[model samples]
Target: MSEAPALPPVRRVGQRSTLAYGFGAAAYGVKDFGFSTFLLLFYNQVLGLPAAQVGFAIMCALILDAFIDPLIGFLSDNTRSRWGRRHPWMYAAALPIAAGWLLLWNPPELSQDAMLVWVFATSVLVRTAISAYEVPSQALTPELSADYDERTRLTAYRYLFGWAGGMVTLFVTYTWLMAGPDGQPDQLNRANYAGFALFGAAAMLLAIFTSAIGTHGEIKRLPRPEIVTKPLGTHFRELWATIRNRAFLILMLAGLCYYSAQGISFALATYLYVHVWQFDTAAFGTLALSLFLGVSGAFVIAPRVANRVGKPVAAMVFMFSAAALLATPYALRLAGLFPAPGDRVMLPLLLTLFAFNTGCGVSATMLGASMMADVVEDSEAKTGRRSEGVFFSGAFFIQKCCSGLGIFAASLILHFAGFPKGAKPGTVGVEAIDRLTLYFILAYLALGWAAALIYRFFPFGRDEHAARVAALAKGEAG
Candidate 1:
């Protein structure tokens, strides 16, 4: 092959690009938090669907989403368009994502089975819409900033925006949308949920548009990645190559474990707070505030932490801390050292734990994502092809599978624990609550610890990334 044309000089990403790119995370927050924090609660607890059924429906959607993820990633990577690979999909997805989310929350009166069908249909639609935007958006991150620490910093800005959006949603939900209907459980009020769904969907539209258009100016300057063609054989070749890449596989597996474990915790947090600890709406809002503070602070400080200790060590430290802190409440409660359910200090203590764990968790999350970006460099070094979209899609695919299974398992556990649906706060029996706590702690510890160990084996760090970039610059790799 003729020598490749001289590559354009790569400029470091600036403040305007970082802010515009980072603003996209607000969509993630609104969509992710709404689905995670409230979907099961709304479908099963409030709307009288079985927990298992709701979980099953959503699980199916995630599975469906996982299948399409890689295809979209591949398409985006090879796409040649004026609007660029990522933004066309990003812009096209905005209105549909909002519509899908809104439809999910507005199901008409129906039998349990009918509701299950509606749930499955809408859930699939919304998740697909998300992947359409999110897979492309995430793929853009590695392209946005070439510096390792700069990527971390840009991601930190992303997390700050995302967590800010999620926090605001929680505050609004608890303060306004959580009003208990007369003769109804606080979570069961349909009107309240409509309002929450509307806000989330609306915010998603605005944020996606802002990011898609905001970043439009840079797409031409972004690498015009060499395209690959020739159908199935080429795909299989690339797939085999991806599988053989050790760093990519490790990052994929560890992310799967961590996110799956997190799914279980998020799915059940409401039950723990309301039935086990007997917290009211205001207290629930306080928990949201704690999470906001923790994640925001982590986003602010995690890049510096990684710079000092390196990304792998920083990842292990933060992830392990999160796991340990998350296990504390259950350990203390089981040991009979925790405050009684109605104790004045109980909420304060729980909020403190939440803040610490959330901070560590978000910190770990930031470093891990940056680590994956480094994998893109390693991948290019080895394969001489840039496939950020496929790599990121694989990450999302793992996350979707793990998260789906986790949600399904959580519902099964709830049923086995005999958790009451739509029950008043503080009404669940101590035995059931104990069992729920045990399940949570077991999952969190086993998965989180294993993931931490796996991350320790990750081969690429700042030095490795820098070396790879240097080779690419000298045309030793491309």
Candidate 2:
């Protein structure tokens, strides 16, 4: 093969490019909101499937879809095209993802077995389509800039927009689309979900295309990998070698635990609010605002914290703090120390603490993503290959497990707690609610703390990353 062309040195990405990159995450956010918040309820409460069946279908779908991420990542890494390595896959994914999302929400009337099949199939389609875009899109972070702090800043914007998109969708769903007739808590109403499906599909399509077009200008400036002709087995071996770094493995493990906790928290959010806390539609809208505030705060908090304490330490602190904050209200309520569900101060107090918890949690997530980007250069310095796609695909794989393992775990909690189906808020028995709260608190704390402690084992920091980048640059110049 001919010698590969040299690329320009990595510099600070422009504001416009950064914003466009961040905006792309809105698609993933929208998808996440739908899956975590409504999918279980929609199937179990509205469509009349059993909760175990619904949760199992979702878990199966996510697990099945996760296997596709690495393949998409590998293909994108070696793709040669006029539009570049990432854009073709990104553009190809838009329509299919939107179509699959629409289908997922609009399943036809069928038997219980057939309905389960529909859920599994549509869930897999949507998740796979999302991977086709998200893996390549996330890989761009390393290609766009090499500075440690800049990567954290870029990741902050990504998380900010991602969370904002979900929160905005949540606000709209509660305030208008899912509002019960005559102020009734009719989240179980079927018609409301139809509106949600349409809105989510349109938003996802727009975000994906906008991001692809917006970042198209960066193709010329980004590095292009040499197209290698090798046996398929040989390619897999190289991929394994590139992704087997100690830092990458630790980050992946940490993400597995962290995202699982997130999955469980998000999956059970509706049940907790509607049944345990007895929040009304108006309160749900307010909750959205609070979450949005927290994620926005994270955009500022993560970068500053990373700059001061280094990404690994900052991530550990925030993760441990977030876990404690998140579980406090549940623990206090169970112990009869916090405000009762109907007290005037309950909503305001809970929302305040939730906002703080979200800020810290999201800060930790942003720092972790930045840390993954740093691993790209560290791997490249040792292996002579840039495997952004492989590494980010590993990250996405862990995220999918969050949906699978986490949601499945949530279903078990519900089953073991004996949570009744189709029960209205404020009507569930005290024993069931107590069991639910206790199980959630225990599981959440265990997973969150485990993820945070795993970060302490990661091998390098800012200085090591800088040294790796310098070494790679020297190799290129030679």
Candidate 3:
């Protein structure tokens, strides 16, 4: 092959480029947040699907996720093509993702059993398609610039756009789709399918356009590995080696625990609003807005805070604080201090605690993502090959698997707690409420703290990253 040309000067990802990337990445957040928040409700209530079936379908999807995520990442890493390593796959996968997503929301007009089959099949398709896009898309962040700080900036920007997309999702559901008839249960009538179906398609298209148009000039065209000589077993063994790395293992475990908690917390919010707070469906929108503001503010400041206190310490502080703040609601509910569900007075307190919890949580999240980038450098030092995609795929595999299980677990908990499909608050036994509230606290506090503490043993700190970067730069020059 001919020698590659000298690359163009690295462009600082200014506001325009950042917004563009954010818009591209927002598809990732919208897909998850919209589906997590509404999909369960849509299936159980709107479509009259049973809780057990939904749980089974989601579990199947997750099990499939464990395999597909890593395979897609590994394939992209070794792909031999001129269009470049990730974007070729990234661009090609867009249509399938959109189509599969839309299919998930609209099952065939058939019997309930047939509907379940349709749902399960579409769930797998959409999840796989999305994994293809996201695994490669995330790889772009580190590949775009090797500078650690620039990577941080790009992640921050991407997350902010994610928050913005989530806000759009929230507004559409609250302002229109999820509007209840009258003001009480039994009078409820809302179906979010229209908004979700349309938005899913539109978001995917915007994602492709933003990424294809914006950063084309910046990414280096990495030489693809020769695949014809290497067999399938070679790829799987290499993937195993990547997973066996101590740093990668630690990151994967941490991502699993962290995202599991996040997924459950989000899934439980509907019950919290309907049962614990007694607010109308629309009121949750206000609470979601608080999340948007709080998390966005934290993303803006997380890097500076991490720089000051060190990433590990900052992560520990924020995560612990969030767990504590989140627990306050359960405590208040026990103390008889909170107003009855749906009391206007309770919204302010709920908003405040949730905002604080989400803000602190997002700060830790930014640090964790940045820390993973450092782990990539450590891996290259050990193996002498840049395998960010492989490592990141393993990391994402854990994250998605945990998230899927978390949602599945939440369903089982709700079932045991007597949160019957479309069951109203009073209809559900008090014992069930007591059980679920306790479970929420434990998932957030206990599981979350364990995930954070695992990071304390991580060896790569800020100074180490600086040193590693310098060494790599020197090696390149030589």
Candidate 4:
């Protein structure tokens, strides 16, 4: 074999660099909130589409994303560019992704079929655009810093900004846009979404570009090891090899289950908060603020938690804690211990539960992502190949696919409960609300714990990764 190309040494990535790159996840946050929080509600309640159809449409889009992501990863891994493989794709994705997102909320009035088509088409474009940026951008992480602990710290910063971005969007949508004209908080106000979409699209563009431009200078400093050129058939062989990695497979499966639960919970939360709990607009805003606080706090706490207990353990603990906490309200309600709607204790109790759950839930996500970063080192050592783009793409792919399944599960539950579209909050039957709540609780508990359990199979850890890095260093010198 030909001599391997010289690669740049791993350096201590500065705080400024992490800050800039970290904010890019803000774009992902914006996209994620749009899909998980509003897409189903907007279509089913506002436009009068069936909940199942709306959920299925988004799922179709996610399926497309699942395939497209890996393709982008493969392409970016093999790409040659002066501005660098990751940056160029990141910059190129900004406007298209933003415009695609904005257009999703602006679908013209049409037949139900036409509307479904619109949702699917727009969702595909938006997610594909996200993949172009996110896959490569995340792939850039291993290049930026090789230190295991520093990777956790960097992801912490990223998740913080990610939470901030989504919180801003939620606050604006709930407290301002959806609050409606005087005395009527109309979340069903279709016009309000136009404003939300405009702002979200603009923010997405800004976040993507800012990170891309900020990190442009560091491209030359990153290692650019020449990939071994192989026949086209070898592509399938490598992909199969990647899939067979036990650690990666475990993470992917767990993430699919966990994020699916999250997707369903997020979709159903507004319905429960406004209808079952009978919270008004201002209270909804407060709930959003509470969730934001929890997520923010968790971001600060995650790196420390990881340092103390190790990443895998920290991820499981946080993940399980979040799930158990999310099940609290429903469990209480089912057992007759929950405060009645409009009781003084109800809102405070709800807020407290939501905050803790959100904090732990987000921390779980950050820890898992950081762990995946470590997996890159392990995978390279075993396979004797660098494949950050391919690996990170799997993470994003699992997230999107599972998010689709979550929405689909929610739709099934809602349909079974006989919940009607366009039904005002507090107007649905007590039976429907009760059924929804119980299903929500069970889904969260089961899926979340299962994810945690599955994650226990990951074999790599501090000593394993350290050994891998040392071996890699020796090989490079040879």
lDDT per residue for candidate 1 within 381-444, as digits (tens), equals: 8888777888888887776666667778789889888788887766778888888888889888
Ranking by lDDT: 2, 4, 1, 3
Off by over 4 Å in 1: 1-11, 181-185
Candidate 1 structure, TM-score to reference: 0.95
Quote the lDDT for 83 in model 4: 72
> Which numbered prediction scores highest in TM-score against the true structure?
2
Number of the top-ranking candidate, with lDDT as the measure: 2
In candidate 1, what residue range of length 10 has the lowest lDDT sum? Answer: 1-10
lDDT digits (tens) for residues 182-288 of candidate 2: 66458888877788999999998888888899898888777787777999999989888887898999999999888999999988899998887888888989999
Model 2: how large is the Cα RMSD against the reference? 2.0
lDDT scores for all predictions? 0.81, 0.88, 0.71, 0.84
Model 4, range 1-478, lDDT digits (tens) per residue? 2232343244568777888999998998888888888888899998889999988888888767767999999888788777766888998899899889888999998999999999999989988998999999988777777777888887888888888888888877778878866543587879888888998999999899889988887787766667677998998798878767888888898898899899888788778877778877678778878988898889789889888988888889988899999898888988899998879989998899999999998888888888888887777776776778888999999887877777788899899888888887667988888898888888889999998887677787877777677778878512
**Clashes (candidate 3):** 5
Q: In model 4, what are the clashing residue pairs, if there are any? A: none
